[model samples]
Target: DAAHTAMWERLDLDIEAHDALLAVLGKFYGDIYLAQEGRLKGAEYLDFVLSEVHGLRIKELQDAKAAGKKIVGTFCVFVPEELTLAAGAVQVGLCAGAKAGTELAETLVPRNTCDLIKSFIGFKLARICPYTESCDLIVGETTCDGKKKAYEAFGEHVPMHVMEVPQCKAPCDRTLFRAELVRYKEALEQLTGQTITAEALAEATKVVNAKRRALQRLAALRAAEPAPISGRDALLVNQISFYDDPVRFTAKINELCDEIEARITKGQGVAPAKTPRLLLAGCPMAVPNWKLPYLIESSGAVIVGEESCIGARNTRDCTDETPGNLDAMLDALCDRYMKIDCACFTPNTERLDNIAAMARDLKADGVIHYGLLFCQPYAHEAMKVGKAMDAAGIPYLSIETDYGMEDAGQLKTRVEAFVETL
Candidate 1:
């Protein structure tokens, strides 16, 4: 804790300094803060933010490299970090800029494609993620058909390399998956000749999971009253978690938790909604591009609750045993994040009913069914939920989304009208 506090002091941050620091950091973009923070603790802290921040930082590294700098571009996920560092290239993540987000993904693939796609598709179509340009190379893993398809389609535009995932399910595939990770490591050696020592992997693990622990703690503070954070504040915390040093972030969260707890004790939280509070259920990413929470919060509504795989579940169960090793830690975190993976595959009314019950518990005024366009599973189930909510006398509204969809003026009018109805 002393180590973390020293770093925060240099940053001139207190626990509540998150609000102020974000006010400053939001003005610029990159991972320098995270790298510096990592050094405050160790490699493990650095590796944690790497999952999301590397892409944002690559621009700095790549720009320097392009101008006669010896920056090697190691494909983010698939390429081994050791190999990339060895190649004299930066270990840039494929989904980096694509992950922490780029722009408002309000269109392109109909909103029904699940939010993560909306993020990539929106960024690619809009051309915001510098990775779309900065990346000298890209790699793909045939993990989920959905992600594979999106990457395959987008890869054609870049120097994309594809790795075949031997299997999708676990047990048989996990070994293969680990092998694939090793194979990916070898491919990096062939392409860049960087040696990925077990030590490096272990180092990466520690840094990355520290970031995970920080993120989890940040999520936990939301459980505080008068919510220790706003949706916008939450975004700031996430930025620090992804880009700043993980150890620093953990310290910050420890401080933030105190500040938030104070606020809760004082009966302060996110501002009360003028509009009837609504609990959003189903896939809400709007493509990782759109800040749906911010949008909703700014719109005078509170996402007092959700059924997102990441929102409640992933952020809550963040107790990883492997404190440092990036690989094992990431696998564990990934599995944890993926567990609540919403089965919007087809809404089970049983689950739907449970969601309604959750909303009731949260004292939500209504339910907003924001399913993406063409999201057959959610679309059908949404219609059912809409009907059920009406019967239960819970005011509800269903909004369909697509990337590059029609008039925002019209959408805004509809949203305004919904608020009025509530």
Candidate 2:
């Protein structure tokens, strides 16, 4: 209780605001997750992560602090978690995806900014997020223009480190990113007061790669006919993967995958047989931004996969564990991070190819390319994705919305019509 109290005080959290935020989460979970049928058994573990998102992770951080460790919070998937782990620190995801605190964020940033960025700004400004508060150093990435500038505002209240993410996969570009990675490694070492040795880097690589393998296993099960797990549940697992402890998260996911395997064997599913399968592409759906997936699933369709950072795009790949030294490990990280086909890239043909491959592999009936309002990179790619899908003879729908429920009914109608066409 003292540790908890200290964390609360350290974060300068507004008790009432924090409680109100949790109340919203409770209602959303009850309405969406509790209403699902025959949910996976291991889903409760992830639910626990949400229910105690800050508490449990903060407890881990406190223990790590007692053992002389530091915690790093990151927003983008580009931040090398392995580096943090190697330097004896924890890397927790701090992206705020909920609708809460938007009013507070708007006071700092313009109303027209993307909701994801605004939500995070709000969470920090409102002091309602323990994970954000628990961070010793907040690592931001230059994935897009908005976030690069927004981090300046965010850094006013919290210590910040911004990674210069390269938009193109040119050899020179990767070299730049590799240098950033090296800089990040040095920063982590200095923060944690721990020198990152070759063994430590190799071990961290193994740990992260194992986590990826577990997620990949779970993903493979989703491809089964009838979908052994709901897309909403699968998405929750992916979202939690960012916050949960790596080893524990991997074990729980593998356990869930085992249950899903049994479900596949028994021909059990959350959706009815022959439900229209969907491939959701574009835009990372952070925690509590479950509107589109919930609407799609409840409207007689099953999401088989996603092409976003929160989905297979982040988990499907693994870091090379063969790096025997620090420099080699950084090179591996650079290679792995560069492989991510973010929309920020100049010629992101890999993303389109990934979408088609996901659609074909998962037997998706249609592709719903969802983007958040004001997220220009993904929004701009919507037309290109539509044209590619059209040429490939795949049904596609592009929907852009903010983090508000006002568009729920309209989105449901559009998604339902898309499923019908499928």
Number of the top-ranking candidate, with lDDT as the measure? 2
In order of appearance, the predictions have TM-scores of: 0.57, 0.97
List, residue by residue over 104-217, the lDDT tens digit for candidate 2: 888878888999999999988888888887788999999898899899888888999898998899999999999999889888877888999989888888899888999888
lDDT of 1: 0.49
What are the runs in model 1 whose C-alpha is more than 4 Å off?
1-59, 63-128, 136-147, 161-170, 173-176, 188-192, 235-258, 273-288, 291-295, 305-369, 375-398, 403-422
Looking at candidate 1, what is the lDDT of residue 30?
A: 32
lDDT (0 to 1) per candidate: 0.49, 0.87
Whole-model lDDT, candidate 2?
0.87
Compared with the true structure, what per-residue lDDT tens digits does model 1 show for residues 55-126?
335445545555643332322133333334433445433332223222344432333345455555554454
The count of residue-pair clashes in candidate 2 stands at: 0
Kindly provide the TM-score of model 2 when superposed on the true structure, using C-alpha atoms: 0.97
